[model samples]
Target: MAKEATLQVRMDADLKEKAEALYRDMGTSFAEAVRIFAKQSVQENGMPFAMTANRKNTYGRLSGYANTKLAAEEDGAYEREMVGKHEKTD
Candidate 1:
């Protein structure tokens, strides 16, 4: 058997409590959930899920435009605009 190591993490008290309750309802502990996440991350060679910036917070009022279509479409448009600006300057 492999030696077990302790992993400590800090988070808001409310967030921790909520996460614990969520995992408990799923018939698992938060610690076990974290372990599963770690194992999956190792297997995937990176994060198990995509990491993306919160567009609503990053762009502020631009979230209003997101109502026109999917939020992904807005994010794509923003990325294209940024690339176009860089191309024009180069």
Candidate 2:
């Protein structure tokens, strides 16, 4: 085998710990699992699973709850005017 290279990724600390524990239960280290995924992706020429979700419009969907407040914004200002439900602020 050729010399191995390091791959660094940063994520939420809690999520990383959860993933590590799950991989341990499955009898594989996180790095080993990532290697298997990389090899499979290379052999398949792309992701080996279907991604049917509309991920490109993600910000639109994610911000829907704040749409009314954001509607009044111009040039991209979105400061909240209400402190909570049924509560208005000065």
Candidate 3:
């Protein structure tokens, strides 16, 4: 038999409730979902999904505009143009 471990995670109350509800609707609990994610990650030898930084409330009026690219092939020219485009902060 495999030993079990516990992992305590802190997150927004509302977010946690919503996620747990969604998991329940899918016939699982949030903890189970996390465990599945962990197992998949191990099988894949890395993260099973792509992770991106949240852009909201970043630093500019448009929030993360300076870090965005117009296209994957633009070579970062889009980021330069996005900066200072919206001067009003917040």
Candidate 4:
């Protein structure tokens, strides 16, 4: 028999929710999910998964919200600078 190892991972709420939702859809629990991963890891060099995907120009998506937010932040910074310049120097 092979020695057993324990692994711990920290994930964000949204990610955890996505994973749990996928597992539930597949009729699985979190512990069973971990066991599945361990089996895969032991079989291959690592678990198979897509790490990230480029989502640029995706319609009605979170990326659009992020872009809009960044532009708003830059506009706010410019307004702050203008206000500081117009302040009374007395």
* lDDT, candidates in the order shown: 0.79, 0.68, 0.73, 0.69
What lDDT, from 0 to 1, does candidate 2 have?
A: 0.68
Indicate whether candidate 2 or candidate 4 has the larger TM-score: 2
Give the C-alpha miss distance for residue 30 in model 3, angstroms: 0.4
- In candidate 3, position 1 carries an lDDT of 38
TM-score of 1: 0.56
Q: What is the clash count for each candidate, in the order shown? A: 0, 0, 0, 0
lDDT of 3 by residue, 1-90 (tens): 364788998767998999999999999999989999999999999877554454443333334334345445577666755765555443
Number of backbone clashes in candidate 3: 0
The regions of model 1 sitting more than 4 angstroms off are 1-3, 54-90
Model 4, 1-90: lDDT tens per residue? 554776676757897888889999999977678887777878887645433335543333444435566677787797788788889553
The ten-residue window of minimal lDDT in model 4 covers 56-65
Clashing pairs in 3: none
Model 2 residue pairs with clashes? none
Candidate 4 total steric clashes: 0
Q: By summed lDDT, which 10 consecutive residues of candidate 2 come out lowest?
A: 77-86
Candidate 2: where is the Cα deviation over 4 Å? 54-90
